[model samples]
Target: MWFVKVHQNVKFHARETTALRTWVPGLGGAGPRLVAADPALLAVVVTAVEGRPLHGAVLTGAEEEAVFRSLGVLAGRIHAGPPSPSPTAVAPVTRADRYAKVDRHLEAARPHLAPGDEEHVRAVVEQAVVLEPLPLVVTHGDFQIRNILLAAGGSLRVVDFERSAPQPVVRDLVRLPDHFDGREDLRRAFFDGYGRLFTALEQAHLATEAVLDAVSGIGYGTAHGDPELVERGRRILARSRAGTLCPAPTPPAGGNPS
Candidate 1:
């Protein structure tokens, strides 16, 4: 089956298809198998992932902890693997490089942003730029909740490798649902699987990533006439300024997010 992704930019489609074709062989069961990519059609064809997106999956209670633990182990294993060897491979990005990307997107969205929010972007950039460099890993550029799929036998299959690239593991870490601070059990299980300790600085780093993610979304939405995405971007910026984007998310009864 084909998992086609249509985008406003053909380059992005081509890039993603190329990434998938080059990387899927090494991804094993963690991702889909690439079949073919036609830049002319702006489409990618991959073997079907017979699974459900994690966002609507029935992972709760003990199952939630188990899934997250497996997720952590999955992340650790992938990050430990070698980077892709593509002719057009996107190299690892630096903290300053990420800040640059954020600036570019935020600037493009300036007209859509409130004057106060624009100012907040500037201030946040100043603080975010001082970050030190970290080691690089092959990142699933968009590893958020939606991209994950629970396959047969409760195995995980991550989709959408179009944005995959070499970047800091922190960039990869940003997408996992480890932010709800009060839910220490899930957090503990996730990190425990990855064999990592949730650190103060990495937790702090997420706020800046959230801001940039918002600005990037806003810029794309403004250009593409996606009002919902634009509105969401604005909301994220508002939260960033108010110090709420990464605030301890209210824990649910089951204490799970994906």
Candidate 2:
């Protein structure tokens, strides 16, 4: 069975897919085997992944934990791999790049928000913009549950690498929200699977990044009349401000953060 992904008139998407055909194999089966890319038709053919999306299951407690761990391990491996060429190949997402994204989207999101939400978003962006650059990796760019597919026996593969890039792995890690009811286990399991202890401040910076994504979603939802998406984005921003998912455990002075 073959999976055919057609980009139609989306030149950018076509090119990104073409590039991903070359990149994913280096990850050792983390992604589908790219069969062929038809640039003229703006399409790609790949071996079909015969599995259900991880999101489509009512997983047991242990199964859920295993999935989260798999996510972390997958993330760790992707971070170790090289970047994909989207518009163009770049080093990594710099703080300036992230700040610019905030500047562009925060205004678009302001009209959809409650009082001071815009300022709150900006403050979060500011905090992240001032921190030292984290280590760079080939981030999956969008590591959401929907992007992951789990085959029988818990084997998994991630799809949609068009947005992958060289950026802070936290950019992907922040995909796991801590505020969802009964999601603490998922969060810890992800980190444990990642096998790298992150500093509290780093996690906080990622929280800030997540808010920026929410702000962008809010703007889209408002323009598209999707109240559910708007509400979801609003909830994420609100929880972030309330410190629901933004952890900043203070480290001792002059001591290395784990």
Kindly list the per-residue Cα lDDT of model 1 for residues 46-141, writing each as its tens digit.
877877888757656787777777778777876776665465645555677677676689778988998798778778878866766556666777
The TM-score obtained by model 2 is: 0.83
TM values, all candidates: 0.74, 0.83
What lDDT is reached at residue 185 by model 2? 68
lDDT of each: 0.69, 0.71
Off by over 4 Å in 2: 8-11, 83-91, 178-182, 225-228, 248-257
RMSD per candidate (Å) reads 5.2, 4.1
Give the C-alpha miss distance for residue 95 in model 1, angstroms.
3.8
Q: How much is 68 displaced in model 1, in angstroms?
A: 1.8
Deviation from native of the Cα of residue 35 in model 2, angstroms: 1.6
